[model samples]
Target: MRARPDSLFNLKKVLMNQPVSRSVSSQQQAAAPQSPQSPHAAGASGSPPRTFGSGHPPRIAIVSASWHADLVGQCRDAAVKGLEAAGPCHITHIHVPGAFETPLHALKLARSGQFDAVLACALVVDGGIYRHDFVAQAVIDGLMRAQMDTGVPVFSAVLTPLAFHEHAVHHQFFHEHLVHKGTELAAACVATLTSLRQIEALSS
Candidate 1:
């Protein structure tokens, strides 16, 4: 099924455009970056990335919130599909109470010593409460901090819109966006993992 136009996210548009990573040449591959860590160090703690020596498929956890069960479910499905299309990924799904709890779930799962990466999904829309912004910001910040603190790669599928009323029209829009977000996140996760592995190979 196709994602709704309102819901579909255009990753090419969403991501900051940059030059693609060039293939490793023997001479350049031999000349690795002087630093052991990349600028986008895995998580919030800033621990050096764990080098697995280039074998094994990375295990990634997809953490989602229960508040927007249906939409998030669709988003999760899209993510799973996207990840599968990319390659074999050990995807473990987890659920939090709401968007506010996504960061903790991501951190906890990342620190579990099982997952290589963490992907979080949530629809943090403004309810009647005046706290959606705070919750959304906190969730994003916490996820970043947690990853740096724990040294695991984390990707967010959580979005906080200025207005997200639960209506047929809004639902249609976000659903499509979720699919795009899923595809985008999947690509990022794979690229990030590959980059990390290349770095490790050079280090050794």
Candidate 2:
């Protein structure tokens, strides 16, 4: 695919005021705040440990951008391989214009209730300006919002590099890096969904 000159600066104007929260543990704590007057503390009931069941396969959706499809596709391929290896499931791939648009599509998919989880992957790079940071933050934040609103688990493999140039060496390195990232994301997806199931089982 021919590289677009303006692609690097494409999402600079979009999602300039959003922030990506990278602290998962902190978010969890905040989500479940403890009250001093409560009769039972968090985890008061010692429930039996539950394992991620393999009987029900999860449905997953992967949304990727078309701008850097060549490199971005590598991430998707790795994600699929990893997910399949982790547990057999129904996986779907969706294509969008760019990273800035991934969240909306992910929201739609999550809301449709057709999938157990959604994963967004992209390569947002600085193009001689501070816009890349904004775009990346917005996309990630948007994904989180979608997850919270829909009660669905969403994963992100979006990366923003401080130094990115149109060079053969850089391209080769990031391509390999994305492969590892994809595997990590897949593992996270499976683990998270399994945990959610276990939590649901607690009430049942």
Candidate 3:
């Protein structure tokens, strides 16, 4: 598939106003203060403990697909909340036209050496095109390749459902589900980065 310059250009426009440190709204900032002692810092109860070995905060890049803007936004917002609640961290959020475009952007960010971790979020549903499976698999494979090529630790929250209809019921259910997935993604990111940091320290 050819690259969509227009979509990428629009993404650049969105990123202009979003600083690299954090892309959260004022409401989220107010809701999640920078506190290391928060109970949710270790992630949902019973999850593995999260430890930040470095003095500086971890820098994360979140690349989200905008096909389902409303649902995707819910996930993004929840992720921001989870990340902030985890502890102080730098986050950069970017948007792409759709899931197909996320891999390239994610790979670019991972190669830049500016972020500790990279994440891709999208809701790829079967549109009766019969190519949803292919697209989803391609996206996931691309993300994995990006991580391996750059060694920057890439994570995916991309969800591909077998059936998704344009109705209030499905929409509501998926919206709520994406929010939960987003939070889980954030927790996983924290845990992974912490473990990598410890391993690096030991190696050094």
**Number of the top TM-score candidate:** 3
Q: What is the C-alpha lDDT of each candidate?
A: 0.77, 0.80, 0.83
Q: Write candidate 3's Cα lDDT for 1-204 as tens digits.
A: 998656544443342222234358999989986765554544556455444445689999999998999998888888888888878899999999999999999999999999999989998888876788899999999999999999999999888876677788678777887898899888888888887877888999
Worst 10 residues of 1 by lDDT: 11-20
* Model 3 lDDT at residue 20: 30
Tens digit of lDDT per residue, candidate 2, span 26-63?
77888986766542334655322222356588899999
lDDT tens per residue, model 1, 138-203: 989999998899988999888876567677867777777777777777777776787777777899
Ordered list by lDDT, greatest first:
3, 2, 1
Candidate 1 TM-score over all chains jointly: 0.72
lDDT of 2 at 182: 89
Between 1 and 2, whose TM-score is larger? 2
Model 3 misplaced stretches (Cα beyond 4 Å): 1-47, 50-54
Q: Judging by TM-score, tell me the better candidate of 2 and 3.
A: 3
Could you tally the backbone clashes for each prediction? 16, 0, 0
Model 1: per-residue Cα lDDT at residue 174:
70
